[model samples]
Target: MPDQAPVRSSALPVSDWQQALDTVLQTPVKARPYSAQIMRQSPTAFLFLIDQSGSMDERTTYRGRVLSKAAAVAQIVNQTLLELALRCQKGDEVRHYYDIALIGYGGLNDEQAVSLWSGAAVGKFFLTPAELAGATLRVDEVTVERNIRGRAVTVTEKRPVWLNAVHNYRTPMKSAICLAESLVGQWLATQQGNDVYPPTVINITDGVATDATADELLACCDRLKALRSMDGNVLLMNIHVSDERGNSILFPARADDLGTDQYARLLYDMSSEMPTPYHADIASLFGLDQRTSYVGMCSNADMDALVKFMNIGTPTQHNHSFTANLSSEP
Candidate 1:
């Protein structure tokens, strides 16, 4: 047979990769609310604004041990990070279901805020579960009490440490929030679609912002909360830790519930309203009746209340089915 010219394939030229990429990117993503199930494809983000102000040096009781407020906050935050890593663990693999940032303010004499990631993840603003798992600064043995078969027993376990307690200078809360706003804005810009659950910002502070007035701080928070995804607005939760033994006000439903305390009311105003999907979890976690939505701010929180408040702010608790599915996978 006579040689014939080769026919061109129907596929587009390899040089047209950008057009193919644009086509894939332009596909419509179904929009969902805050109830969207978090998975590897649409992972969530957590930004922790930790207060390392001079007031954090005050003594407080945490997990039955007396320590500085900074120490207690570090412990709780470390535990929370560990729990998040564990949740993302399926078999031997640590899935990337979250991007976490830990920013500590007022920890230096210069009143600067900076990333708190230690070890391999030092100087990074955001981290994946696998990165966090490998970035431990140290490991310490921790003792805890547990009930088994109607008997209470104490046990010791090794806990990895990433953040350390640092108490110095004054609270630069406004600066920290502004930095968070910048970081979150950049993060949301990179998200593939609007259906990803909005980032959650948990501000753990012991005192008022030294750089900004109450109104200014609230304005900063307003700007942060206004940055939203299809799942919902960015959830800004404030936790005011105190050494005083006063009763803590948590998840209050009204400004009236905050009484005449001007700072508490300001925090209430700064907080994002608790999303409807979280109402059931809040009720179950705090033993409250789910009649109305609550504010995301907690005032005068001691170490114990601080832990409970942190639990409610974190998005991991809402992904029970995700964890179950991961467990069942081979």
Candidate 2:
């Protein structure tokens, strides 16, 4: 480490979910349009790092039947990414301002870990989130079963469904991050020579670092913050999942606002700005004139508690004041 000190970002502290949403909503277009393109020299990119270690195989009751935490997360992220990837002029499943890369980590039967490949890696039928969302899952519904004190009840409920997002994974999240670095490096090289900068990277995880790869993950993300082009810079956002509960398990349970939880506030603090197009639009969707929101999932109280303690996204105290600190350092 240099005598200079670590880079501190300029994000704001959140008070609740609504506050986070408000910030998210306002992030893209305060001054004008083309927020996405304005932010990224070329099309923006969003990478989803989903944790699929074997630990995720642990089954728990939702409605009535048992389901794994990995399954639930895969569904949510898949749906979100598929939706995020919009139609470009090509008429194919191309994104106008958003491009997605679904990286799976910790799912393996071998000795080495950190399998950070796209969604199609589990199979070859389809390759992207758009394709995965269109695929069918073995189970269409999750049975909602909850134990109040000790009693167990079963109920079957259908969600959008997911396929191949997870399978035979282990907990080498950090190792997966190393792979992420390599892929990202390749991507950056291609972009740098062309003078294009992407938007952000989104990471979704379910457990702690057994591989002790936080530094690697942070390093990869840090590189993201450094990427600059005619637009602005790339950002890396982290989404931590407990993959246990339904509505109540997540902070600021109400989607309408984000002003209630300390954890929610921290999440926003670490959140990257929305892609340019979404900047003004997301706020419009939330009916917040100018604000951002914090969005994430947790499996249960234990998971929620853990996320609260573990910081995500960009921390507060970010200042682009010092030129040296503001510039990319690798």
- Largest TM-score belongs to which candidate? 1
lDDT for each residue of candidate 2 in 1-330, tens digit (9 for 90 to 100): 011111111122323333433333333322332232212234444555666777777664433445776755665553454344332213554433434455565565322333233233332211333444444344365567877678887878655544354556455655544544444444444344232334445556555656554455455445545444334555555455554454333323233354564444443443344443333432332334554432333223333233331222211112211111112211
Error of 1 at 301 (Å): 1.3
* Poorest lDDT segment (10 consecutive residues) of candidate 2: 1-10
Candidate 1 lDDT, 1-330, residue by residue in tens = 111111211133444533443432354433545765567777888999999888899999986789999999999999999988987888889888789988888886435567777676655778898898667778999888899999999999999998889898899999889888867766666674545677899999999899888888888898888876666678899989987867678888999988899899989999999867667766776777786778998899888778878777764554532233222333
Q: Which candidate gets the maximum lDDT versus the true structure?
A: 1
**TM, every model:** 0.84, 0.50
Model 1: lDDT of residue 233: 76
Q: Candidate 2 versus the native: TM-score?
A: 0.50
Candidate 2, residue 197: Cα displacement in angstroms equals 5.2
